[model samples]
Target chain A: MSSQIFSPGLQQALDLVGIFVFALSGGLLAVRKNMDIFGICVLAEATALGGGVMRDLVIGATPVAAFSDLGYFSTPLAAGLVVFFLHPQVERINTAVQTLDAAGLGLFCVAGTIKAHDYGLGFVPSVALGMLTAAGGGVVRDLLALEPPALLRWDREIYAVPALVGSTVVAALIAGNRLTPLNAGAAALSAFAIRMLALRYGWRAPRAWHRNDSRTSEE
Target chain B: MSSQIFSPGLQQALDLVGIFVFALSGGLLAVRKNMDIFGICVLAEATALGGGVMRDLVIGATPVAAFSDLGYFSTPLAAGLVVFFLHPQVERINTAVQTLDAAGLGLFCVAGTIKAHDYGLGFVPSVALGMLTAAGGGVVRDLLALEPPALLRWDREIYAVPALVGSTVVAALIAGNRLTPLNAGAAALSAFAIRMLALRYGWRAPRAWHRNDSRTSEE
Candidate 1:
């Protein structure tokens, strides 16, 4: 595949937006960790692009996107700049960051699925890669922040499940030869709505049997 | 295609040995991070099996080995127990730890390549996965420890390169219908020797021009 196809202007725009939100999330986590600016930026970059880079390499794409595209590499840098200069103001708007992050989760799920499909992966693998691409960065971010993985933590809202749903819808649509812009929009909407509902209603997966055993016995 | 083939008694033995060394390295890193017992165990498990788990999932192997094998999962717990009680004694044998770590790297590279080949990947991708399986865990460990990744640091020895060489040799032998226990032994020895030499001699790749222009230089 031509790098040009991967660099369509619209995709670039979406990637930059995703990076900004991802970096903001990372910065917020770093603040919770009381990290310096360097830590914040490193975490931000890892959160924004770590998944995509891993996906690209696994699919045998040479010169991973993070290394090949200056714009892609610099998106987190811009976000880091914002965090460095406006952290105090940013801290007051955590809700807005969460909303944008939800949007990023939706966008990345679609983009990652498409990328995996382009590499000729089967639908199941594409959906799996999509979820990984959407959630892998957050996993790294939380690990670096020394928090339990957000996907594994009891307090996390519906995150990976929504991304999985979105990717599944997209994969099914693509397989059916109905992957038009409208279908993509619907898939993204489904993911965004699920995440928003989870946030607003505090939706969460039921913990496995073992998870509660320790807590209930402690109490 | 048989899970039994992959989970053979010999593979289990190799995995146990690799996990022990990897867990030791991870525990050492946790000591540097000042983590508690739980944190040390978490890091140790992540370090010992994270790379292999990643390689398996990428290759579409379900029920990741680390999760499926009670012995594999318990290895890190055993290591954690040792660290909790014998950290001072372990700390005094830094050289021994390094040697064991080299052995683990060799085992991981071979096992990763063999698994990837079983999944029907081409030679190049198998080699790449092997290198990733050898190095990816330590990269995650360093990220969690808030240290520069050993693979990315300027002080890098022949860490990835040795894995690449070993995996390539294994793949080539398999392709040529010359693979045997002796060939496997030769490949592992080659990888371990190169890694030890690099460690002793401080070998590293040349940086690309302008590579240090990024934030990594600030370190």
Candidate 2:
């Protein structure tokens, strides 16, 4: 329950890194949608902080950290501005962005699980909250862009699965009284590796209904 | 700060009524979109409880009421099921549904303002949260349907204005030490009337730019 495992400075740094990468993703989506500068900023902020805000709210931490900390609020705006002028350059580094995004996902899932457990949630809810904290921002971003959420698409590279794996590992470690900063880092690294591997291998979750099954139903 | 202003029975009844109407709207949207039964239920639940859950989380009420109360969870599913089977009849009563939706918006806005105040938020945030409570579910519903949020569109019948008015009324009453159950009911009624009037009159809020304005920008 103690928030002392990761020092305040380390936590803040991790949070900022996650927020920055997520904001970049959101800004790219906004550009693809042909939205204006204001729209880009809005989406960027939502993608960066929406998940964390949701997590904080559910766990009774309010006046959310985003509102309390000026840096958290401005970081996304800065990201948006950076993308506004340098989108062409940013697009060239898509692979780099994806790598950083994987890191963000790993960090958010582990941190969210820890926060949920600290708030006294049970194991299952903690894991669910962790996934939400990792993937909820992208969901919000896609929704705003009027696209199906990438999280729910069976065809996409495994997204929530990695977050789930990391969260479960963190939860199991806590339950076994083996949780330490080193082990938590390892948990995040595992998620990062899983996500990167999935992308590299074009791994996807299975679809519920096969094309031939639907054709047979039609007949 | 006490949650006792509205009796538990009365609050529960009001909440159920609001949820049912919101869920019906969500179900109707799902039907229009040709989503399956599971999708209908998911959208219905999101439309009915998303706003309240958001408000509750931001105000530090953990484990949100929707998660704790079985009735809150089930009511939306019931509405979705009803709509799945009887959407033709439900669509026929579109006017009636809109009337009830206005009522839901009114009730939610007032209650949200009161709760935010109790949670020690400032006046502006309380009112903002109230508007979010009134309109947030519908926004989520539209986003899930891959449409622009109704609140942000200039063409819609002034949806958020009534909610803002009602929340402000309740907040001012509380600040004046004249808040009573009777007065709160009157506040909600005021919102309901305003919304209905706007619909009836085909009233629209003015947009900052016209279609020609964009053409002028090209010059």
Scoring each candidate complex against the real one, what DockQ results?
Answer: 0.04, 0.13
What value of lDDT does candidate 2 attain over all alpha carbons? Answer: 0.84
Which residues of candidate 2, in runs, are more than 4 Å off? A2-53, A61-114, A121-128, A141-146, A152-219, B30-46, B53-93, B121-128, B144-146, B206-219
Interface RMSD of each: 11.4, 7.9
- Top candidate on lDDT is 2
Model 1 ranges off by over 4 Å: A1-219, B2-10, B210-216
lDDT of 1 by residue, B1-219 (tens): 532223367767877988988988888789778999987898889889889887776666767888998998999888877887888888889888888888888888887887777777767667767877888788778877877666644445758778878899988987897777677768877898889998998887543222223323244
lDDT, candidate 1, A35-101, per-residue tens:
5454566677779987887788667654456644557666786786677667767777988988888
Give the C-alpha miss distance for residue A197 in model 1, angstroms.
Answer: 30
> What is the C-alpha lDDT profile of model 2 across B111-135, one tens digit per residue?
8898899999878898898888999
In angstroms, give how far residue A56 of model 1 lies from its true place: 11
Candidate 2 versus truth, CA RMSD in Å, comes to: 7.1
Ten-residue stretch with the least lDDT total in model 1 chain B: B208-217
